[model samples]
Target: MSIKGKVAVVTGSAQGIGRGIALRLAQDGADICLVDMQIEKLQGVAEEIRKLGRKACAFQCDVTNRSQVFEAVDYAEKELGGFDIIVNNAGICITKPLEKISEEECERIFKINVFGVLWGIQAAAAKLKANKKKGKIISARSIAGHTAWAMLGMYSSTKFAVRGLTQAAAQELAPFGINVNSYCPGIVDTNMWTEIDHGCAPEKGVATGETWKASVAGIALGRAEKPEDVAAFVSYLAGPDSDYMTGQSVLIDGGIVYN
Candidate 1:
């Protein structure tokens, strides 16, 4: 599973699951390019990767922008000496009843969660092909993608869109030896979950923490997910061990939403 001396670009790497993936890849012997709008926090992650004895570069980027996404890939290859992996992990979660979903809210979530991944795929694929190298393109999906929750309908739709993109891109890029896949996480203990919990609380007529607790109770693993749990699976996808695996929207959500 060694990815030693490889270069990887991880978006939304300033915190949460993205940060975990970036650090794990570095610890496993890959130089990293940390991409996020949070420049200060991104630099902090870069410092941590450097401490792990891996080269790291922090690039401020808005993944929703096609031009910026392309630029980031180019910058990563130039600074890190090569590009072999890309994790399109930047996304926003929206919680609302289907009828209550406004057009603007729908667009906002899709732009970040869906279009961002598409742009990352395009940019990474173009770069890899230009360099005549094969690479991995990973994106963030969710258990909601597999099983659409009522209050999270919009967010679920975006994730489902990502799954479609992953499958299609995998087929299209396979001829070039490029693999494209997505990771589906469930009830992670991150700020995103905090938002989900709070958003569901009002609809459930319960306190914020209660919604979160109830959701976790359904997990067969009997615990809320940690960033490292998702990171571990992502590490496999980013490494050579998963070279033969592509077009998979894998659920790393304990035992929930089994496909």
Candidate 2:
């Protein structure tokens, strides 16, 4: 699946899954625009892409802010000469009991995970349409989006919203030749999962590593997920092989959820 000469914009690309996707796309011969709140980390990823001989730049933007996202997209397109892919990988997960999930937490999660994706799609769609270019818009979802877990009520709800928006945008953008889709990952060993493990450690009465271990035990593959696992799938979707597939949230959860 070669995406040579294409340009991709990846959000939350400072590290973890987003960083992995940015680097993978670069490796596959695509110029990349790395977007994240961490300016230093973003620059690091950008440097790596440059080392690989790809034109890359890092943009500091908060996904939750629609204007910032639009500006970032515009900047990326200008710097990269054109744009073909936008991965709305910037998201947040605040694990807590249902009773403990405050309105502020819920709204913040939606703003980042749900609204952020929406803003990306809207901004990218406009640019792709204006350029008369077909594009791919991908977002990050989760297995919890398919089946809600005990302490992740709010995060699950946000991913669920992402799934919904992906389908809706896919259908709406079809006429413009822009495909919208999402990837649902399970138990990726990223900092997000580390935070989940630590946050639920006391409430679940388990040690920090135990929560992640138990979750892995339930995986049919019996293995922990890595950021590259998710990135590989995203790379496929970003490439031309997935042009026929849209309005869908493909799961890469190690068989954690079958939907």
Tell me, by lDDT, which candidate is best.
1
Task: Please write out the lDDT profile of model 2 over residues 157-182, one tens digit for every residue.
Answer: 89989988999999999998999999
> Which portions of model 1 show Cα errors greater than 4 Å?
none
- Positional deviation of residue 50's Cα in model 1 after best superposition, in angstroms: 0.6
Model 2 misplaced regions, further than 4 Å: none
Tens digits of per-residue lDDT for model 1 on 202-229?
9889997998898899999899999999
* Candidate 1 residue 135 C-alpha distance from true site, Å: 0.5
TM-score per candidate: 0.98, 0.98
Candidate 1: residue 196 Cα off by (Å): 0.7
